[model samples]
Target: MKSKNYDYYLIILTSLILLAIGLVCIYGIIYYNFLAVKPEWSSLYAEYIEIMNSYLYPFLVLLLISLGLCIPKRLLGQDILIKSSALILGATLVLTVIFNLEAGLGFILAVMIGIQSMVLIMTFRKSRAVRFEKHGYVVRLGSSLLHLGLVVLIFNFVTLRESPSHILIFWTGTLLITAGTIFALYPDRITRLWYTEQ
Candidate 1:
């Protein structure tokens, strides 16, 4: 008798998923900064840089992927209400791309980022809240907020790079990370404010 390799299946599936998302995140961070500033590489390929800096291609791909995810396989089996809505959304995305509708594209991009940000925050809250509580209340709350702040600060660096508030964001993230680390390492112990002789 032979057994199914479920462990391998899970490992491979998780690894691929993580790599896919991580690669895109890395690319966006690096390329967006590239678009923000013209170094030797951008200067060398000025034509290509100009095209990419416009952001149409990346926006099209991202919008397509985001809207495409709406038409789930389960929805395909459902009644017209759900399926029609999905179809409408799909068609809207297609038309937006075909027509190069600036407003629609911008709105969709905002929606995509807003939805993902909400999900990301919820994920951090749900997963970290419990784990941190195990250590202690002060550690849990302090560390979780600090970690979230650190992430938000980093996100600002990426998206709000136009202002170049580098010093503030960098220090904020560094402080958050440091405080979170301290909270994580702080020992869990009982404390007494005043001792009375029994």
Candidate 2:
């Protein structure tokens, strides 16, 4: 990667880490409507602090790194970083699952993350042989949207039961997934507006 790109990535990584920390600090403050009795928010917050201090932080670190690894080659650049990151991601996931390590949302995210990485890697390799893919940007954008929708769907498992229905997000994600699939699989059939190049 170029120096400018590295700088941007560094900025992004710093921002994501800061955002995650902020989220973790505010985690227990989230209100759920269905509790039979108002429990001690302070104790709950303390318990989570302890959990994070004990071992959860490492898992979060790994997760953030995995997220970074999954950045598409088109966004990050066509570098060996993608391949290396994929290998590291797969190894971390397999070892974590096999060893029975525990972290909140770790198991669910692991499966989806692994699958996403594999799919992206395979597609990156296979794209060169694909035919009827006239507009490269459309396919790449669609692939990114498809993955984003899949991730959104996966997060449904993490929400509280009493929280507002995720159906709206679900349908929106379905739309993105459908549109993305069409853009990726039938690029040639896409309208002429996407063809800006001669």
The whole-model lDDT of each prediction reads 0.46, 0.54
Candidate 1 stretches with Cα past 4 Å from truth are 1-135, 185-198
Provide TM-scores for the models: 0.35, 0.38
Instruction: Provide backbone clash counts, one per model.
Output: 0, 0
Q: Quote the positional error of residue 100 for candidate 1 in Å.
A: 13
After superposition of all CA atoms, the RMSD between model 2 and the true structure is 14.6
lDDT of 2 by residue, 1-198 (tens): 664576467567757776776676565244222221457655566665555444445535454454545443333343665675666566656755676433334454555555555555555565552222234656765675576565555454333224577777677668867887887776665635556553
Residue pairs whose backbone atoms clash in candidate 1: none
Question: Which portions of model 2 show Cα errors greater than 4 Å?
Answer: 1-70, 77-135, 160-162, 193-198
Q: What is residue 154's positional error in candidate 1, in angstroms?
A: 2.8
**Candidate 2, position 99, lDDT:** 62
- Which candidate number has the best TM-score? 2
